[model samples]
Target: MIGVGKIKQYSNVLDKPLSKGKQEVSLSAFAFLFSELVQYNQTQVDNIAELERRLEDAGYAVGARVLELLCHRDKGNRRETRLLGILSFVHSTVWKVLFGKVADSLEKGTEHEDEYMISEKELLVNRFISIPKDMGTFNCGAFVAGIVRGVLDGAGFPAVVTAHFVPVEGQHRPRTTILIKFAEEVLRREARLG
Candidate 1:
């Protein structure tokens, strides 16, 4: 026989409110775990591009769940349907949830109407990473790109997202910029809606 307190009551556990989607892990712990993820993926891939894609795929899964949670808990289950709406949500809300801060910048591409970029000085994923000399231009932020893509795609704004490293004047390490090129259908839909 168990004591009164020792007996777990399902009602008590069920009565508690759900998290507001503000959960976080320490940066050090995240770095360690992310490193392990990279190391494990390294063994399975033949090249850096493949590894990055795999990581992006993993991030995509996380992003989908994140959208589901945030929609239910924080946003009152409202989904962003407009292009700018979803972009803002990903740039601000998603980044804040995942990285503890909003993205440094979200800008439209000067050369393309359908392209946008989310730039971060030192993205959380790339902060602790030290790329090998052989792995030229391999930004760990591909995982983050995946997250952005996942969120956008899940929210009915399908787009092609890629991560790039852009040199900043006087900065030793380049910043990670996520480039999002919306699908033609998405662009058409946007124009019609506007």
Candidate 2:
């Protein structure tokens, strides 16, 4: 678990005047830093997938710690366990805690009993991501996916989260949909209990 003092310090940094009421930070800054991060990880890894995975893992660690702190501060306790309940918590409370807004949409997969989707446009970190042709496999969406996974796992969801880019017809910015598929045991246990 992350310490309370650290979380508060980080939040305060984000709330600085430069953040401007937390409206949004500079895309250029995020992009440049993220690009450098990716490049640095690339040197440490053998392939593109590994580099992306490293980024995702890093995001997941942050998410886990953030979730813990948020729950501690707001709920004065821990988080929920029910699938739909925790998903809602992640979509609204967790989203706001991290990105300052609720997700655009949250839906369960009609076709898959164990799957749910959390969709959002204007993903904070990916606002300026422009993947080059050579780096076709690169997608900053994985970071968000890792976040979802971390939060859910912290709340005992035990799910696999994947981030996808799905652009709406009129939306200029890319929309990211995080697909979460719960482990079979979770669904079975929920069904048995309910």
Among these predictions, the greatest TM-score belongs to 1
Task: Please identify model 1 stretches exceeding 4 Å from their true place.
Answer: 1-16
Residues 1-194 of candidate 1: C-alpha lDDT, one tens digit per residue:
45888855567765655645436778898899999999999999999889999999998998888898778767878998888889999999888888889999999999999999999999988887888888999988999999988888889988889999999999998988999999999999999998
Name the lDDT of candidate 1: 0.89
Report clash pairs, candidate 2. Answer: none
Query: What TM-score does candidate 2 get on C-alpha atoms?
Result: 0.79
RMSD of each: 4.5, 7.4
Provide backbone clash counts, one per model: 0, 0
Give the distance in Å from residue 8's predicted Cα in candidate 1 to where it truly belongs. Answer: 18
| lDDT agreement with native, every candidate | 0.89, 0.79
**Displacement of the residue 128 alpha carbon in candidate 1, Å:** 1.4
Task: Point out the worst 10-residue segment of candidate 1 by lDDT.
Answer: 13-22
Model 1 root-mean-square deviation: 4.5
